[model samples]
Target: MTVVTLARPDDADALSAFAETAFRHTFGHIYDPADLASFLTGWNPPDRIRAQLADPDWTIALVRGDGGAILGFVKLGPIDFDLPAGQPSEDATELHQLYVDHEAKGSGVAAALMEWGIAWARTRAAILYLSVFTENPRAQAFYRRYGFVDVGRNPFRVGNHIDEDRIWRLDL
Candidate 1:
């Protein structure tokens, strides 16, 4: 069985590795190798993960398989991206990253992590926001099922490549 729990500083290395692998499996084909490598090191490095784990404002939940391998994870934190005018940016939270190992894709891991994310966000703010690649229909549909609607377009930078991402919002 898989279990979801709060991430600790000690889990940073494993989380960082899993995050890079999951991201590469999902989107590596779209970027040049150098860009992908740069993005991984800059964004998912162990030191960064450790820092976030130690920060009070950030929450990371990991789904661990029976043998303690990381199967998935989700990150929640204060909104860092621009929000549309009139939106409650000050009190809003963001679902920064939600990823599942490729082998766990059809095993309901994502849903479990998302459920945890939404519940966790409810305690922090009234609004929850996230971004999804515009070309990713599967992810878009999943967010829609959770009542997250597209509110605007945001540019997501992965190294030097900019992807047109749709900003999604859910009223918690």
Candidate 2:
């Protein structure tokens, strides 16, 4: 059995371990090694996550297994993106990352984290939004199934790879 809980700063190390393993296994084949390394380290290192847990504005939640391992996490917060040349700005609470360890994938960990994130944002009167790599079709499909509709695209480069970021939104 698995349990979902709002992550506290004490779970920082566990969060980093899960983030590294899950992300490495899932995206290692799709993204360049160095870029993927930078992404994981930049976002979920223990120290950084500890700081985020201390943040008053960010909502960070996690899913844990019966043994109390942090299986997955979702981080959401208010953000303003300055649009590129023909785009307009948006008021958004971005889902920075959602990841589940291989052991926890089929047990509904992802859904629980997402549900918590949506509720967390709703309480703050913020709309839910996220950006998924265009190449991650499975993730895109999953988001769509959860009532997230694609509203825009961001064309950008990550390291040596050219990628399109599909933006999806859900009403709070």
Candidate 3:
């Protein structure tokens, strides 16, 4: 049976590699190879994952398969960008990243990770925030099922390309 649990420091390297693979599989075709490489190297390097693991504020969780291999992961933490004045609740945490192995699609791994992330946010924040690519209707629908509403728009850069993103918030 698959199980979701907190990620340990020793899992950083594996998580970094899994995240890179999952991300590339999900959105690699939509961007230039160079841009994808830039994003993978800059945003999800092993060092960054290690740092996040060591940070107390970041709650990183992984969904492991029956044999204990990681199938997916999620990270929840404080918002990284400046929020608009007087809009989002004061106690809000960001669902920074959620990635599931391509082979694990339709296995409920993503939903489990999201459930863990939402519960994590509930402990410290009243609202959960996330950003999804504007073009990704499937992901938007999934978030909507979890009560996330589009609150604004932002630009997410993949190398030199600026992709539009819809910011979503879920009130806990």
Candidate 4:
């Protein structure tokens, strides 16, 4: 059985490693090697994960498989992207990252993580925001099923590379 739980400080190292691998498995082929390395070093380093784990404003939920191996995770936190004028920043939360291991696809891990993230976001803000790579139709479709709609496009930076990402929002 798989279990979903809040990420603890002790899980940082494993989470960091798992996050990097999951990201690479899904999107590494699209980026230049240098860019991918730089992005992973900055974003998935163990210290960074530890810091996030300690931050009261950030919430990371983990899906652990039968042997306690991480199968997937989702991160929820304050918005980091620029919102359009008239969008209430204080009323919005961000789904910063939602990833499942390649081996766990179709095993319901992503849905479980998304459910946990949405419930967590609902308690903190009236709206939820996220960004999906324009090329990733599967992720876009999954988000759409949760009532998320594309509001605009945003530039997502990975090292020196910039990719267009679709900004999605869900009114809680």
Query: Would you estimate the TM-scores of all the predictions?
Result: 0.96, 0.85, 0.94, 0.96
Q: Candidate 4, residue 62: CA error in Å? A: 0.6
- Candidate 3: stretches off by over 4 Å: none
Residue-wise C-alpha lDDT for candidate 2, range 6-116, written one tens digit per residue: 888888888888878876787678788887766666756889888878887786788766677777888887554433443333444778789888877767888888777
| Candidate 3 per-residue C-alpha lDDT over 47-90 given as tens digits, one digit per residue, 9 for 90 to 100 | 88888888888989999887878899999887986555555657
The full ranking of all candidates by lDDT, starting with the best, is 1, 4, 3, 2
User: In model 2, where do residues sit more than 4 Å from their true spots?
Assistant: 80-91, 155-157
- In TM-score terms, candidate 1 sits at 0.96
TM-score of predicted structure 3:
0.94
Which pairs clash (backbone N, Cα, C closer than 3 Å) in model 3? none
Model 4 RMSD in angstroms: 1.1
- TM-score attained by model 2: 0.85
Instruction: Give Cα distance to truth, residue 126, candidate 1, Å.
Output: 0.3
Error of 2 at 46 (Å): 1.7
The CA lDDT at 2 in model 4 is: 55
lDDT by residue for model 4 over 1-172, one digit each (tens)?
5568999989999999998998898899999999999998889777877888889889999999888899999998889998866666888899999999998988999999999899999998999999999999989999999999998878999988999998899999
lDDT at residue 161 of model 4 (Cα atoms): 93
Per-residue lDDT tens digits for candidate 1, residues 24-116, read 899999999888888887887899889888888899998988888999999999888887766778678999999999988879899999999
What local lDDT does model 2 show for residue 121? 76
lDDT, each prediction: 0.91, 0.75, 0.86, 0.90
